[model samples]
Structure formats: structure tokens, C-alpha cells
Target: MSKDNFLKGAAILSIAGFLVKILGAVYRIPLANMIGDTGIGYYQTAYPIYTLMFALSTAGIPVAIAKLVSEKNSIGDYRGAQRVFRISFIGLLIGGVLTSSFVFFGAKFIVGKLENTNAYYALIALAPALLFTPIMSAFRGYFQGRQDMTPTAISQVIEQIARVGIGLALVAVLLNLDKGLPMAAGGASFGASAGGFFGSLVIIYIYMKRRKKIRKQIRRSEKFEKEDTSKIIRNILIIAIPITIGASVVPLFGAIDVAIVMRRLQDIGYTQKEASGLYGQLTGMAQTLINFPQVFSVAIGASLVPAISTAFARKNFSEIKKTATSGIRVTLLIGLPAAMGLFILAEPIIKLLYFSNPLEVQESAGSILKVLSFSVIFLTLVQSLTAILQGMGKAFIPVRNLIIGALAKVVIVYVLTGIPGIGVKGAAISTIIAYVIASFLNLRAVRKYAKIRFNLMDIFLKPVLSVAIMSIVVAITYNIFEGFIGLKLATVVSIGFGGISYLFALLLTSTITSKDFELLPGGTKLSNKLKKIGLLRR
Candidate 1:
């Protein structure tokens, strides 16, 4: 893939990811307001079970397809590419049904292990989502494999929109009906099914619209016969199994928090309600807030998956090095400032967004966010690095690293969370620790396999310096304005000011240049304007 096109693809997905996240925040902030901490606990506890199922049925197969298809398309084997998609889609659908059934029929047993029996209704409500999510994800993976990020981006926004609107509407309905928190939480959980169904429709519609064109293209390229179905499935399984195992391990972080945190707290003599509230603070509040900042890394990392696959297929080591290096640099450039800003403004931001929640809950959540904020840098690094490894056909490396991290997290959570003074904050700490370990291992593997040397200046120092400057701006902006506009409005203004200042800081340090912005939509025009004003390199 061309560098410019690759970066542009990442930008498209990044914008879409950010928009989806904003919609999520808009939904969940209000949902939290309506449900309170206990209700949030139920919602979050149930959500992970859905996420686990979604990951299992969807994660490994699409990735395997994406890589396989990219290799086929790179060689002008469009027929082979289409065959891979057909096979993977069928497999994904079957897997989706089985996984969905497991969750639907086994909700009680699953939640029993999670130590959150109140999530039973939520899990039941969410099970249908697994049926469609794998299908939606399969289509997304196929499109991404073709390097057409637009369809996937469009589907993401539409999916999140359906989720937010339907979720809140159901939440309002169930609450108005005087249903208890569990049933009301289940209403909110059903939004995942609505979203997956709608998202699947969007992609299916797009695919149907493009079917004739794909067929026509395929007809023109009868270069080689398609591989046998068994061979294709075998190739797919080789890649998919490791990825599935790895991706499955990822949600286990949440599961670890779910299983360990509440029970550990209770073991230390905390009441069930208190332990549940703490769990909600970590998962419901902080986890939701942290997700928005990750769009940059997530977008670039996802784009890297297929891009790296193509490069690896062509034996283009220089291209792989260039792209992987760029991914890491960009991840850092965005992640550093995001983590610092979140750390600096964690309290006000949490309070501003979750205004309807009790002060105690909000404050407790703010503290959790502060500790978790630093993980932004580490986790984003892990994400980009893992993508690099996956694209280079080393999928199991990340799985091994992540599993090690998760094991460490299990130990940390067991030990730290039971401390009365430490409580749920320990879970946040463990997340960072896990990412630190995983990122280090992934980066080491990338360097060894890809034979790339990273410039600390580009990937680390400049970003750190820029973030240092931006943090001062954010802290001062909030402090100055809080006395006049109140903490909520001050938080808003500080964020606006902080964003602008970070841009200027980046420009002043030559940390980000015209070349980088040129990858974004309207970036060329913005670069021209910035150059004319002397803010960008000529």
C-alpha cells in the first residue's frame, strides 16, 4: 500500500472512531446518570460477557481473512480473495450462532463465575447481539482487507448511532416502568443487538450494491483457479486460532477485573454493594472515558493490519519498516498528549461528563481515571506494536505477551484490590502495569522481526515535550476559568483551549508537520494555510 493512502485510510477510520466514541460517551454518560453506580455495575458486568463472545466469533477469523485476501489481491488473484471472504463469512456466521447460544443459555453460569449475578438479565438481553456482531465484523474485515476503509467507517458510525439511540430509549422506557435496576440495565444492554443488526444491514447493503462490480472485476481476472475449500479453511485457521486466543485474552482483562475486584473486596470484609460500586467506578466510569482517546491508535493499528499484510506478502521489508515506524510515531504523538490531558483533568472531566451522578461516585471515579490515564500511552503502544507483529505474520507473539500481562494483572488485582485503602484503584493500576509489560514485549518483537530502528526523537521525546507544554496549558486554563465559569464549563473551555494549544505546541516543536496533516481529510489545504502563516515546515 502507498504510504499516503495508508495514512489517509487511518485518518478516515480515526475520525469515524472518534465520532463513534463521542456518541458512546453521550449515551453512557446519560445512561450512568439514569442508572447510578449499581445499575452501571450490572450493565458493565453483562457487557463484558457480550464482548467476550463477540471477540471469539469475530476477531480471529476476519483478521485471517483480511491477511489472506490482501495477499491474494496483491497477486491479482481476485477470485481467491473472494473465495477467502465467502469461506470466512460462512464460518463466522456459524460460529456466531454457537457463541450466541452459549451466552444466551449459559448467562446464569457465566455471571455466577463473574460474581455478579445481577447481570443475568443484562447478559440475556445482550446475547442476540453476538448473532449479528460476527457477521458485521466479518464484512468489516473483508472491506478493510480490500483497503476500502470508508464502508467500515460508515458502518461504525451507523452502528454506534443505532446503539446510542435505541439504548437510551430502552433505558428510559424500563426506568419509567418502575422496573428494578437489573431489568432496566438489560434494556440498555439490548442496544448491542440493535446496533449489530443495523450495522450488519449497512455493510450488507453496501456489499449488495457493489456485488455486480466485484463479479465483473473477478470475471476479467481468471488467472488461476481458486484454492480448495479445505486448504483455504486450513490457512484461515492457522492465523485465526492464535488471534482468537489473543483477542479472547484481551477481554479477559475486563473479566479479571470483574472476577477478582468484587470478590477480593468482599473477601476483605467490604459489603457487596460497596464492592459493586467500586467495580462500577473502574469499568463503567473510567473505562468509558479512556476509550475515546484511543481512537487514534486504534485507527492506525487497524489500518496497519492489512497494510502490513500486503507489504509482508510482497516481501517489502523497507515498506514494512517505514509503515510500522510511522504507526508508532503517530500513536505516540497523539497518545502522549491524550494521556497527560486526561491525567491533569481527570476529576473535572469526570464530574463534567457525569454530572447527574452522586458526588461521591463521581469523585471516586475521577480518582480511578487519574491512575488509568497513564495507561493510554502504554496501551496504545501495545496496540500499534501488536498490529505490526500481526501484519508481519507473528500473531502469537502478542498473544503470549498479553497473556503474560493478564496473568500479572490477575496477581496484582488479587493482592492490591483487597487492601481497604487501595480498593478499586488497584484495578486501574494493574491495567497500566499490564500494558507496560505487553507493549515492551511487542515492541521488542517488532524490532527483531521487522529489523527497524526507531528514532527516539520522533517516537518519544518530541511527543513527550509537546505533551509537557500542553499539560501546563490545560492546567492553567482550567484553574483560571474555574472561578468564573464553574468547574463544568471551565472543563469544557480548558479542553477547547488545550486542544488548540497542543496543536501550536506541536507545530512550534516541529513535532507534527505538513506531511502528517496531508494524510487527513482537507489536510492539504490546512497545510497550505499553515505554511503561508509560517506554522508548518516549508
Candidate 2:
């Protein structure tokens, strides 16, 4: 694929990821309003466990499949690619079934470890998704490996639509039935399973539609050497296991939080209800908002793996360097502004999005969000660099780095959160510190493997400058407007102004060049338009 084609694929996934996150926000804000913090606690309690399991089951396989297939296809080993997919599919199916069975049967045992006994039903409700999502992920990985992101992007939107619509509807129905918070949350959890079911159906239909072409290609590849099944499975595991471990780090920390945070809060003398409420605010509210900007990073990371893998397979060092650098630069360009914006506008954003909550709850969430805002830059870096490492076939490096980070997080959480005044905000602080550690380690690994020289001026300094200018403008605009206009309207206006100001600063400083624009999806057209209007140089 052309460079532009790679970017276009990333763009499609990024846009879809953003839309999925928006739908998630819509689903979550309303659910938080309806169920309140304790219910959110119950719901969130089930999710981390589910995510950890899902990560083990599906996370690495798609990436491993994508990388393996891309490498095979790069060398014209079509038979090898098809064999990889077939073996991977069967393995994932068996693994998914096993994990789902464990989660379903061990629901009570799992919740017993955590403070939230009410989460048992939610755990059971989430079990079926574990079975379905891995199958969907296998298809997604196969297509992504082929450098076709359309199927994965379409499946994502379909999944999120199902999740939001069905989850909310179930919550409403359960509420009307006069079910308590735990049962209502359980109903919402069931919607997650429903969404996975629908998502699998969508991917299955797409696969069926394309089966004829796939079979034709496989038949044509019969002349190529065929690998043994055992070898293929071993290769898949070799690639998948490290990626799975790396991807599981964040969710593993989340699972740790589910176990530690509430119990610690109760130990600090808070009532069980109060402890759950605080945990709910930390995970359900603050973390939800924090995840929005990460959609872009996740998209870039996903796209980077296959793109870099192809280049690596071809032994194209320049392409690998260019792809990795561009990915990191784009991550900073998006992440810096997002972190700054969230830090500056935390309260206003919380009030705007979660207005249904009481004022004090909104205020508390806002404080937690402000502390969490610092994580955006580090998290984005970790993600982008991890992808680069994985693409370079150094998959185990990120796993090691993340383990160190997770250990740091555990210590920090134990010490800081144990204090009476710190409480939930300490968790946010520990998260930032953990990502900072992981990002640095990943950066060192990338520098060593990719041999990329630092270009601080272009990558880091310029974006930071532009973001600083934008933050100042936003703060001033908001301060002036807040005195006369309502908070919401002022927030909207200031955010608009800030975005425009940031763009202008980036252009005037040449922090972002026309060449940069040309690398993005539809960027060539945008560059041409800007040049025609005398906004961008020739």
C-alpha cells in the first residue's frame, strides 16, 4: 500500500474509534445519571475482569494475526497467511470458550475477592461477550493484516451502536421493573453481551460475502509450501502471547483497582456505600472522559502495527522509521492539546456532560479528571511506542516495561491512596506515573530498535509551544465570557476559539507543514485548499 493509503486506513479506523467513544460517552453519562455512583461501581467492577479476560482471549491474536499475515503477504506467501488465519481462528475459539466458561462459573468467586458483592450478577451477564468478541476480533485481525481496515471499522461502529442502544434500553427496562441497582447494572452488562453478539453477526456476514474471493485466493496458493499445523500454532502463540501480556497491563491495573480501591477506602473508615461511590466516580466518570482522546492513539497504534510490520518484512528501514516517527508526531499533536484542554476545562466539561449529577458529585469528578489529565500525553506515547516495538517484532519488550510500570502503580496506589485526604485522586496520580514510566521504557526500546534520532523541535517542542499558546487563549476567552454568559455557552465558545488558535499557531510557526498534511487521509486535498487560500505555503 502507498503511504497515503496507510494513512487513509488509519484515518478510517480513527474516525470510527472516535465515534465509538462518543457513543460510549452517551451510554455512560446517562447510565451514571440513572444508576448513580454505586451502580456505576457495580457495573465497572465487572468490566475490568471482563477486559482482562478479553485481553487474554482476543487482544494479542488479532495483532499477531495481522502481523503474521502481513509478513507472509509481503513475501508473497499467500498460503502461509491463510494457514495462519485458520489456525488462529480455531485457537481463539477454544480460548474464548474456556475463558467465558471460567468467568460464568466463577462469577461469585470473582466478586467475593472484591468489595462489591453486588457485581456477581454483572459478571455473569458479561460472560457471553467474552465468547463472542474473540471470534469477531479474529476476523478483524485477518482483514487488518491484509491492509483492509474497512471491515474492522464498520464492525466497531455496529458494535458500539448495539452496545449503547441496547445497554440503555435494558437499564431503563430493569429500572421500571423496580429492580435494585445491582440487577439494573446486570441488565446493562447483558447489553454488552448483546452488542458482542450483534458485532459478531456483522463481521460474519462480511466474511461470508467475501468467502468466494478468499477461497479463490487460497486455491491459487496451493502451489506454495504448506506449513505444519503445530508449527503454525506455535508461531501464532509466539507473536500473540507477548502482545496479549502488554495489552493486558492497563486492564490488569484496573482489575487491581477493583480489588484494592474499595477495600482500602473501607479500611480508611468510609462506609461500603461511600467507598463504592468513590470508586465509581474514579472509574466510571473520570476514566470514561479520559478515554475519549485515547481513541485517536488507539487507532494510530492499531494501524501502525500492520504498516510497520509490512515494512519490516520487506526490510525497508526508511519506511519503518518514517512510519514510526509520523505516528509519534501525530500522537503528540493530538494528545498535548487534549490533555491541556481537559486540565483547563475539567469542571465545565464535567458539568456539561454529567449535568444530571448533583453539583458536589460533578465537582468531585472534575477534580479527579484534572488530576487524570496529565495521563493523556504519557498514555498516548506508551501506546504509539508499544505499537512500534511490536511491529519491529520486539513484542516482549513492552510486556516487560508494562510489568515494571504496573508494579510501580501498585506501590503508588498503596501508599498514596491509603492517606485520608488523597483517596481516589491518588489512583489518578498513580496512573499518570505508571504511564510515564512505561512510555519512557518504550521510548528507549524504540530508539534502540528503530535507531531513530530525536527531533525535539519538530515532534515535541513545536507542538508543546502551539498547545501552550492555545491554552492561554482558551483560558482568557473563557474567563472573559464566564462573567456575562452562561458557563456552557462560554465553554463552547472558548473551545472553538482554542482550536482555531492552535491551528493558526501551528501554521504560522510551521510546526505542521504541508508535507505533514499530505500524509494524512484527505490531507492532500486539504493542503491544496489551504495553499489556494494562501493559508499554507507551497
RMSD (Cα, Å) for all candidates, in order, is: 3.8, 3.4
Write out the backbone clash pairs for model 1.
Answer: none
Q: Candidate 2's C-alpha lDDT?
A: 0.87
**lDDT, residue 433, model 2:** 93
lDDT of each: 0.85, 0.87
Model 2 spans > 4 angstroms off: 1-18, 63-87, 142-151, 208-228, 302-327, 391-393, 450-457, 531-534
After superposition, which runs of candidate 1 have C-alpha atoms over 4 Å from their true positions?
A: 1-18, 65-89, 138-155, 202-229, 302-326, 390-393, 450-459, 514-525
Candidate 2, residues 1-538, lDDT tens digits: the string is 8989987887788888889878886687888888878888899999999989999888878988999998888887777898898889998899989999999999998888787788888899999999999899999999999999999999999998888888889899999989988998898888879889999999899989998987777667636667889888888888788778777888998987887888888778888777777888889988888888777778778778987898989989888887888888888888899999999999998888778778988898899899999899999899899898989999888888988989999989878887999997888898999999999999998888887887889889989999999999999999999888989999999999999999998888777766566435577789889888878864
- Using TM-score as the measure, the top candidate is 2
